[model samples]
Target: MSQIASTDWYRAGAHGIDIRVRLTPKGGRDALDGIVALADGTSVLAARVRSAPEKGAANAALEKLVAGALGVARATVAVASGHKARLKTVHVDGDARELSGALTALAESIGTRPN
Candidate 1:
């Protein structure tokens, strides 16, 4: 099993992950925005969304898009803040480094890299 599987982070009801996400919200032709990468052990994945924040639709879409991409259930994701802003929080369940690396790859594909 992956380290994420061994840690309590995935234990449900305990040890949540933080990702720094960046939303793109119509970067051009892309239907949805890309998820920006944050450091590990953070709940700010910096996920970018192509949908505008209209009546909480963007936020919901973001949750689905991000959770799908991360291979986690939507229950694992939530907007800790920035409901009307571009940046938001993404809670995950997994190992810090593993999750971070996955997000970094996703971000890189969209021409963004984590620091």
Candidate 2:
């Protein structure tokens, strides 16, 4: 629904993320990739999914991917928005700072450098 050039997400706690996401399905993988955009017009971790968007396959894949990236249990990540749309919301259940560092590290790994 909206366009964000980029964003830097930091996990402060289980609910560190106070942002929005515009998910993009990169079908053809078991992993999830999409843009997590914030109000400041920042985004990062453009996730890519190997699974096709069907029967929650994409959703599951997204959860796994994000959880793995965040180093938290898949159960920790919950879809907070966009069930039937390309966009979705995932909430973390932990410390805000941890999530932030994790996100920053992930961004660095992918050379995305979210800011």
Candidate 3:
């Protein structure tokens, strides 16, 4: 795992953390691709889901994927914002530092650390 900063994708809050994700619907698989920088220089976690972007299917899949990645219960993860957009903010209910560490490890395992 390279030395990538977790601040690029997640931020610790009072209860847990908020994660910024750029989701790709109908991506043929559910997976986290790593971190990426948008044109505005804001970084986001790149994720893909096999479900189509219809009637919140993609959003549900994203929540499941994130919960699984962070080793949390599905009920603990929710799409806090961006219900109809490609980019979304997810809120996880847990220890902020623990969740952040899990996300950092997951990103490193995916080998998509930002340069």
Which of the numbered candidates is closest to the native, going by highest TM-score? Answer: 3
Candidate 3 structure, TM-score to reference: 0.91
Residue 93 in candidate 1, Cα distance off native in Å:
4.0
lDDT-based ranking, best first? 3, 2, 1
TM-score of 1: 0.56
Instruction: Give lDDT tens digits, candidate 1, residues 1-115.
Output: 1112122112222455565455656543223333323345322233455666689877777778867776777986786667777766556765656665666565555442333
Enumerate clash totals for all models, in the order shown. Answer: 19, 25, 0
Regions of model 1 farther than 4 Å from truth: 1-14, 26-47, 94-98, 104-115
Model 3, runs deviating above 4 Å: 1-4, 113-115
**lDDT (C-alpha, whole model) for all candidates:** 0.54, 0.61, 0.88
Q: When superposed on Cα atoms, how far off is each prediction in RMSD?
A: 7.7, 5.1, 2.3
Q: lDDT: which candidate is best?
A: 3
User: Could you tell which candidate, 2 or 3, scores higher by lDDT?
Assistant: 3
lDDT per residue, candidate 3, 1-115, as tens digits?
A: 3444668778999899999999999999999988887778777899999999999999999999998888899999999999999989999999988887888788778755553
